[model samples]
Target: MINVIIVPAFQDNYLWLFHRQGSDAAYAVDPGEAAPIEQALRKHRLQLAGILITHHHADHIGGVNALLQQRDIPVYGPLSSKIPAVSRPLADGDLLTLDGGEISFRVLAVPGHTLEHIAYFNPDEHLLFCGDTLFAAGCGRMFEGNPVQMQNSLQKLADLPADTTVYCAHEYTLANLKFALQVEQNNPALLARQQEAQRLRAANQPTVPSRLSLELATNPFLRVTQRAVIEAASAYNGRPVDSPAEVFAALRRWKDNF
Candidate 1:
C-alpha cells in the first residue's frame, strides 16, 4: 500500500510525503521548505526519489535547491518557466511512477490558479494532489488565469472518480467551508461538514484528504450548476444564472471578497 504523510510547511502549506509501506524509498510533493522535509526523511529513514511540483510559485518550489543539495533527485514540473533545477520538464498527459510500485501518477495540466498549474493523479490509489487549483469548498483565486480557465480546470478535476481523495496544497478548508455555507446554507451535508471541520480544528487536527464526493455535494465552486448555488450566485450578482460560465464568474467574484 502507498503510505502518505502530510508534512506541514510554511504557515499552512502541506508537503506530501509518499512511500510504499515497508520501504525506504519515498517521494515528496510541493515541498516548499526543505528543512522540514529533510528532517522528516531522516526521521523516517527514507530516501528521496524525486520531487513533484505543481507550479512555479515560491511557496511551492522554495526548497528545491536545498533538497537537491542533499541528493540528486529528479524534479518534474511544467515547462512554463524556470523551475529552479528541474531535471525533467513535464507537461499535460505525463505519467510518473514512484514509491517502488506503490504509486503511479498521471499529470494533468490544470491551469487558472496559474497558467502552468498542474495536478497529479494516482488512479490506482484514487488520490489527487491539486495545488491551489481546487480547494475543499472553494476554488483558487484567478491570479493568472480567467474564471473560464479556472472553471474548466476545476471541471476537469471534478470529472475524476467520485471517491478520489483530494489533497490540496494549503489548509484553507475551514475558511472555504464558511464561504460555502453562506452560499449553500440549507445544505445539510455542508453544515455537517462544517461542524466536523470545526471539531477537527478544535482538536488541532488536520482536516484534509477530503473525498471528491463530499466536494461535489458541498463545494460551492463545484456546484455552479446546482439550483441552490446558481440562485445564490444570482442573488449575489443581481443577475440571472443563464449559463455555467456566468455562474462560475459570479461565484469567483463573490469569493474574492468573501
Candidate 2:
C-alpha cells in the first residue's frame, strides 16, 4: 500500500515522497530543497518521517540540514562520510524496513555517477529509487567512477525484474530519448517511446517512473551489447568498440557532448 508522489524541484530535479496509503507518515528521497518538500507534505497532509539520500550531490542533499532543523527525523543514505547528515548509513545488500515495517527496501551499491551512490529497491513493490545512477533513457555523467563502474552499476539495475518502475531523480526523458534515437535509429520501440515522451512533455507532465522493460528496450545505455548500439558507438569513436563497457563509455561521452 505504499504510494509515491512526485514533488518537482529545481529546473529538472524530481524529489520523491512516499507514504503508506492510510498513513500520514511519509519519507522523502533526494530532497534538494526543503520548501518544495514542505509544501508537498502540507498538500498531502502527511508528516515527514525520514529522508533518503542516494548520493552526495548538492542537488540531492542540499535541503537535508534545513529539514532536520524543522523535524528530527532519521536520514538514511550510503555509507559515505561526504554526507554527514546520514543518521543511518547503509551498505550494499542491507535491508531497511520503514513505516512500521509496512515498507521495505534493499540497498544496492550503484556507484558510477558518484563513488558513493546507492539505490533503493522494493522487491515486493517492483519499485526502484535509483537517484541519478540510471535515468529514463540515459544515465548520469561519470564524475568520479570509470566506465567499468558505471557499466557494472547499470548492469545491476538491468538485472532487476522487468516490471520494476524506475523512479530516477531527473526530468531528462525527452532529452535522453532524443539521444537514444541517434544511437539506435531503426528501433521502433525507441521511436514509439519518443512519441509518447513528446506527448507527455507537451502537456507539461513528468515522463519519469518508466518501466524497466521500456528502458531495456529503448535506453541506449542499457543496450550497449546490442549490435546497433555497438556500431553507433564505434562510429562515434572512429574505431570498433568491442566490449560492453567500451560501448557504454562511448555512448556516455556522446551524450555528454550531445
Off by over 4 Å in 1: 99-102
Task: Evaluate model 2: give its TM-score.
Answer: 0.99
For candidate 2, which ten residues in a row score worst on lDDT?
70-79
How far out, in Å, is residue 119 in model 1? 0.3
lDDT of 1 by residue, 101-179 (tens): 5578899999898999999999887999998898878778888988778888999999999999999988888999999
Best by TM-score: 2
Give lDDT for model 2: 0.95
Candidate 2 residues lying further than 4 Å off, grouped into runs, are: none
Candidate 1 Cα lDDT to native:
0.88
Work out the TM-score per prediction: 0.97, 0.99
Backbone clash pairs for candidate 2 read none
In model 1, which residue pairs have backbone atoms overlapping below 3 Å? none
For each candidate, what is the lDDT?
Answer: 0.88, 0.95
